[model samples]
Target chain A: MIKRRKFSEALFKALGLSALVLAVGTLVLLFGALLIDGVGRLDWQFLTSFPSRHASQAGILPAVVGSTLVMLVTAFVGIPIGVAAAIYLEEYARRTWLTELIEVTVTNLAGVPSIIFGLLALGLFVYMLGLGSSILTAGLTLALLILPVVIVTTREAIRAIPVQIREAAFALGATRWQTVADHVLPYSASGILTGIILALSRAIGETAPIVTVGALTFIAFLPPSPITDQPPYLSFEWLMSPFTVMPIQMFGWVSRPGEDFAANAAAAGLLLVGMTLAMNGLAIYVRYRMRKRVSW
Target chain B: MARPVDGPYIDSAGRGDWPKPLKAETCELSFYYGTRLVLKRVSVPIAECNITALIGPSGCGKSTFLRCFNRMHDLYPGTRYEGAIVLYPDSRNILDREVDPIEVRMRLAMVFQKPNPFPKSVYENVAYGLRVRGVKDRRAIDEKVEQALRSAALWEEVKDRLSALGTSLSGGQQQRLCIARALATDPELLLLDEPTSALDPIATASIEELLQDLKRRVTILIVTHNMQQAARISDWTAFMYLGELVEFGPTKRLFTTPAKKQTEDYITGRFG
Candidate 1:
């Protein structure tokens, strides 16, 4: 019986290892394929030039800038709201049916389809509010899309703090806000930042939501500069400009019946993947630094 | 002193004669969690500059009684405090609705079962209480941090690495840091809930020694599971069982003389 148990354990171990290998193997394969198809087109000119009818001359400059600005807007709009909501729900909210219902709704919202968010944005931002098919609308759409991700992660991070830490602070005569500001926020900072970065990375790759918000398929012009040469230099005009994102640009190219457009799509996909990886890397670095400073 | 310091004596009423002036005392203090009663009318006297140790078996609500002094139960919902935890001199009921828990906490400090230093520098950990009170003067904070660490018997070892993370220390040192954190505020009463329960013998010995010295500076109320620890460290010992104060008297008398049958049974390890 012992020998049979040992054999079964060995079998289960092998099965788990193979499952891990299968998961990682697929990612490696996809990355390898992107490199093979897109590496040739991924150069300085491709990065700097605008999209054109000729796939060879076409560049992702507008899409890259658009994606960056839209991401900026999304971060600005989403992070505070998400973290605040998370803090309120986790720390301040009393356990009642209303709060429970809100919690359940927030969690369920994270599982809702991305396309549904796009449809919501289309009706809400495009027509009802009339924000138009602009950078602001696209940003708002993506922000809504990633709100659940941010809130869930922030809540998870806050919940990770040991109760003793808070108790110690409270015992020291710290008020609730003081305890939260001094100990809770500082202790859970690394987790919250990691969550924010991961959520942003998720936001960066989103295509369906932005498209549903009416992002342009092709764009050659850049948004107005955020800083001006004149007094009161900061500008909000860029937020109102029509824009295209990396995914939408790639999606547009991938639809056309040509190897050249397909190459462009592949190259754009590669850069998007690189951006996502870089954000995730930053999240990991932040977590490592935080863990080094304050481990329970 | 308002109250004369007489030698230890157990009166006819079975209550120990308090030798020193009272720092605080709970009068018919009953605590409830939701509908269930836990600490049932526990009225233990905490003498000023004395170590009053509460010894009970697990789940006897000794820790719950300790928490009542600082209103720690108020952090959760549905826990009710009945009767009064009266602070001396001022003669104010700390558990009264008008009395803020934060105000109570400011005058009192607590050390937990496990070392719970903040995820900040050792200096910052020790300085946190002052910071919350808005004592922003750098030099004042530094002096208090040093003084607290010194009192906790951890200054010499950690003076060089004040900027080091509090959690980076050994378990014994971390507990000392927590004590230093509590001491930094110059609290009138120190509540320690099994502070050395999680430590090794060597660490526990050092903490016990520190607590003995600390009683001269501030009133201490500690809860310990180890009867020997209670015997070794406390001036007064309150033996509790099933959420009731079974016996309370001078440590020597409680350990030796028969106060009650249950206290004797538990002290002799008849059953928890």
Candidate 2:
């Protein structure tokens, strides 16, 4: 009986070790494959030059610029509104049926597939509003796709704040708004920023929604000039003009039959990975600082 | 013991000796949570710059009654109250539907049982009340924060680390820091609900001493479950039982010879 028990315990330990090894091995293999194919094709011209129709002529410059623009626009449009909605729901709203319903809706929205948000943007911005398939429409779609995530993360961050802090603020002759702005918001700012970065990272890699919203597969020019033009300027108008982001261009490359196209796809994937990793690292660092600052 | 034949004790309930008029006057104030009534119709005159201590057992209504001063009862959805809580003779009654509870809180400051510093630097924590009041001058803010910290007896320890976070302080220091935060606004009345209950004996002694010093400048109403604490710090003591204010008088009389049997029994620990 003692021997059997020892054998079973050993078996369990072995199983656990094997599971961990498998997970690590899978990640390393995936990264190794990407690097092996991607490192050979990467160069300054590839990064700085515009996309071309031929595999030899193609570069990721326009796609990179387009992605950066869309990501910034998405961050600007999504973060404040998401955080404000979260603050309102968590801090100010009474526990009525309406608030409960809103909470439920937000949770459900987070679970809804990203593709649905794209379809919604297509119908509303493209067809109904006549904004057409442009960078603005794509950004808005991406923002919608990630809004619930940002709201949920921000709400959790705000909710983690002790009620005593709010009480202390109120006890100091501060109005409710004052208490929220001065005490609650400052304390939660780091956490909220971390959440925004994470949400933006998620938005950056998304291709399904933008695709459904009709993101251009190829574009030769940068966005319409943001400041120089009046209304509807194509030179810097991210909101109104056709644009091709890195992920969309990468998808097009990967689907083609040529080895050069596959190499370019791998290079673009590497860039996408680098962008997301940078965002994730920043989010993690901010979260760490916030933890230290808020530590009791 | 002989009662003082002279001084304001004889006219304790009169209007002329009262300073700042009455900010809040509770008459026959009784509170109930569900079917359990926590405070009986207990009347007490809360005077400015005088410290009043409410002493009772664990379940007694001292803390609940203290909460009533700022209309904090509104925060809890199910808790209800009866009788009158009149605010600043000119303002509407607290129980009236028209009065905003937020306005009441703006006049009264409260320190809690535990030290709850917001997750902010010590400087930000002290400047918080001032900033909320829209004081924009950097020099004035720096001066007021120093003054408030000094008054709370924490400036010497914290002056160099003003930018350091509030949570980095020792437990006693955090409680004192909270006191400083409360003092920054110069509130009409300061409510301390077992402010030292969670501290060690040494920390408790420091907070007790600070409370004694603070009473000379601020109107203080403290709720304490410790009979000895009530005796040590309070100028006047109000003994409560269950939900009723059994007896109230000078601290010496209340501790030495309580007016009611319930008060004596509670003080002696015969029964809570």
Q: Best candidate, lDDT-wise?
A: 1
Q: Each model: TM-score of chain B? A: 0.95, 0.87
Candidate 2 B-chain TM-score: 0.87
Best by TM-score: 1
Clashing pairs in 2: A223-A235, A223-A236, A224-A234, A224-A235, A224-A236, A224-A237, A225-A235, A225-A236
Q: How do the residues A1-296 of candidate 1 rate in per-residue lDDT, one tens digit apiece?
A: 99999999999999999999999999999999988899999999999989999999999999999999999999999999999999999889999999999999999999999999999999999999999999999889889988998899999999999999999989988888888888888888999999999989998999888888888989989999999989799999999999999999999999999899888999999999999999999999999998787689
lDDT of model number 2: 0.81
Model 1 chain A lowest lDDT segment of ten:
A175-184
Off by over 4 Å in 2: A1-3, A227-236, B1-24, B34-36, B86-96, B138-140
lDDT of 2 by residue, A181-295 (tens): 8767878888888889988988889988889988888777887667665455444445787888889999989998988889899999998999999999999998898777776
Please estimate how well model 1 matches the true structure, expressed as its whole-model Cα lDDT: 0.91
How many pairs of residues collide in model 1?
0
Candidate 2 local lDDT, B141-207, one digit each (tens): 9999999998889999999999888999988899989989888878778899999988999989988
Candidate 1 local lDDT, B193-218, one digit each (tens): 99998999999999999998999989
